[model samples]
Target: MFKSKLFDSIGFIRTTFLIAFFILIFLASITYRHIKELDKISYSIMNTYEVSLELNQLISYIKDAETGHRGYVITNDSIYLEPFIDARENINKSFQSLSSRIDLDTVKQKQLSRIYDLVDKRFYYFKNNFSSKTEFNNDFRNGRIVMDALRKEVNKMLRNENKLLSSKDRLYRYNNSNTPLIIFSTFLISILTLGYGYMRVIKNYKDLMNQNIRLKIFDESSKQAEILGKYGSWVYSIENKTFDYSDNKFRLMGCEPQSFLPNSDNLLDNIHPDDREIIINAFKDIEIAETFPLLRYRIIKKDTLEIRHFKTAAKFFTDRLGNKNMIGTTQDITEDFNKTQLIKLRNKELEQNNKELTEFNHVASHDLQEPLRKIQTFISRIEDKEKENLAETTKAYFEKIQEASNRMRILIDDLLQYSRTNRSEKKFELTDLNTIANNAISELSESIKEKNAQITFKKLHEVNGIPFQLEQLFINIISNSLKYSKPEIPAVIAITSTKTKAYEKPKLKDNSKREYIKITFKDNGLGFEQKYAKKIFLLFNRLYGKNEFPGTGVGLAICKKIVENHKGYIFAKGKPNEGAIFEIYLPV
Candidate 1:
């Protein structure tokens, strides 16, 4: 748009300048005839033969000044201002011409000197800083005043001859009357148009510069990100059949950037011998399918002689010119691939270990318990058959043996339950907590009755979890509370559930975008010291002696394991003699 406007302005200026030139030409010709007639008429009246010619020459210089001023106004060009300067210089020529007449020219010299001084006065205003419209207007008005002064000076030079000259000069004067004002109006319009265009150009240039800077910054930032992330990008032009690689792309191939030009052959050379066909098919696929599907392949590093993993994804792009290009990124995933393989090996080892542990669990549950049962059976037989003959100490030792066997049986049972919790085949089903809690209460009905415990629950939330494991969780926690209940006070276990977000509970540790069912079991039991809250959940971790609390020290550990299986968390909060709260958070 700026270029078009500039061309239009140049064209307008050319037309105006040409029109001014012709107008000046037409005025000059008329003025020339008028001067010729005045010269003849004056010679007959006075002996001033060179007077008319000198005066006509002066008129031509004035015409040059007008044309210069008009051009300067129309074009707003410094080049046009040169004519004003030229007029100033050429006025001296007019003075010199009128001076060397060698006729009785004392009066002419005085009058000519006054004209020269008036010309100087005319240019004085212009010579000052005159770029603005107001300055131009003032200079133009001064020019008209000087023109009048100069004409008056000319008339005074030959008073009697002027009467004949004035009659002929009137036609020339009338012809050029409105030229200066018309030219000045064109000058103002031209200045306004040019100023507006210049401002728009500056504004556009600034906007373009800002966009370019942002693009360059983005390019640099993307390059840095690729380097830090161990990735590289490449572009393939279908029209040119050429390959262009980012700097990091060359580095990934174990060479300095641009050390080797990227082409299909060179790219294939970097690929592992076993995986080279995969890359060959990738390049072929761009044209065959017009798309490159995801490809995970291996490349052999030239420097390290080690295989590195690479995965590429690309899409076909047609630019504004309809040139097809395939742009893709390949990342160095050696670390991630190796870690994944290591995890698979570790998982296999764990599976084998779990199988052995399951076998051990069977042995502990039955094989080991068989011998213990027999020992208990032998003791029972001795007490029934020879009770009178046995000593009191001997009877006491037998009773102690019975208690040890019972404790051992309890230990084996608890260990077996813990092993099942560790099993990985946990199938999740949406289990209602209200039903689970009621089931736990019914199962422990005898214990609840004996302990005179109150197990109250309401508004228990539901969650997707293993039904059997969740049941075991509720049973173990309730049993634990009953076992620790204060002797003087009836046990009060209140189970309640509320909906909550993960971040709301910092103890959950994982601030994911998930909703959790916070099932809290608050019990008025003989709670332990707050310091042992975390320690109480470990395997065989007992806060009190076996006589104080008859437990295998493994029930809470099993509860933690079961909660973890359901992708949940449990925390134990306690106060000495006050109460204990077991918080179980399962994802909803």
Candidate 2:
């Protein structure tokens, strides 16, 4: 609505200019009128000033004349008479000027006439007294009365003129103050109005230019995207048997952009010999199909002979004249295809290696166990037969040999369990961890009894996991707590479980959006430092010497493998002489 009223009237720019012009003209006219008014008031005040001066001069002359007359009558001095004479002439001249100045005021003119009459009477009385002593005595009282009346009249006239002067001066001052204010107000208003209008006009124009520039930028960006994305658009006109490929399409074929018009023969020539028949069949089928089918094929670059993968998708379109056309995009998928192939190759290689490793672990454990068992059996027989007769050093050496064989046996057993944890059948079942923890405790009954360990657990959450592995996970952690208990302190192991979100476990880097069952194995055992939390899970990693803790350091490694095979995670937290907590997360 504002645009219609302003812009449609005379165009926005022109209308704004016209409005500014008129505002300036209006301001100038107002300023001129105020100045004229100020000048008029000033002139009137100057005239009033002259009247005030005249009134003061008239009073001064009257005083001088009275003094001269009094001095001449008392001392009879002619020198004093000169002053009196000059004052008399000056007094009449001042009165005449005062009368002319006050001609515009009838009341003031009347007051002046009365004052003149009283002065004339006082002059007559003084003239008669100046001549005779007896006449002076008789007329002295009347002369004093006339003199008093003249003074009263002059005072009245002076007061009236002063009031007139004051009124005119006030008017002049008012005009003087209002003139500048009026001019400044008008000028400021005009300038502000013009500034606001021009600013809006400029802003609108810039906005329009920016919109146009943005549209051009978007168009350029779309073309640049097609080129940088290694894709190009094409339109095939079936009626004319002509193919129109974009500039990028030509470049994708290893020809100069827009070098030549493309046709079916040219496209087929670039196709790999193995995929040529497939494209030919697809093209023939699309001629009758209602919807276009996606086609993938390989093409050989004309200049470099380099093979490139291309995928094309088109839609069937009919023009107004019923001409059949196909519009499609062709993307160069060489890089993506190569990456996919490499990933597949890596996955196959990893699968074969894992199978070989699993087989080797089982075979090695099986083959090494026979010798280990035979050595242990022979050592046991030797101890039973000669331990009593052997010397003390020989007896100690025999005991050490038995201890080494036993350790070797345990190491092979633990190694087999660690490998089997990864190769075991991974079948998920809804298993209650309360049952699993109880089962682990049952398996460690002998150790728990020896240490007087108090193993505590509550109603735990059930989760989807491999049940046997979950059982083994609890056994390994609880067994560690039993083995590492502080001296003279009964081992206290607490097993607790709760339903929790994956994000709550900061150490478990997995799918954080899922829910999991967090089972905590907290124990008051001889805990290690916090820094060795991750190190403890590594295979063959031990925090204490073999003499201090008896086990191949592969127990926790087996526990980690079991949890991972069940798609879960385990981490440990420890503080010296305080306790250790082994936290496990299994998806629910």
For all candidates in order, the CA lDDT equals 0.80, 0.83
- Model 1 lDDT, residue 519, Cα: 91
Per-residue lDDT tens digits for candidate 1, residues 314-410, read 8889887889998989899989999999999999999888888886776667677778788878878987898778799987887888899889989
- Among these predictions, the greatest lDDT belongs to 2
Worst 10 residues of 1 by lDDT: 40-49
How does candidate 1 score on lDDT? 0.80
Which stretches of candidate 1 lie above 4 Å from their native place? 1-225, 303-306, 342-367, 380-389, 458-461, 488-492, 499-515, 520-525, 569-583
Model 2 scores a C-alpha lDDT of: 0.83
Angstrom error of the Cα, residue 499, model 2: value is 1.8
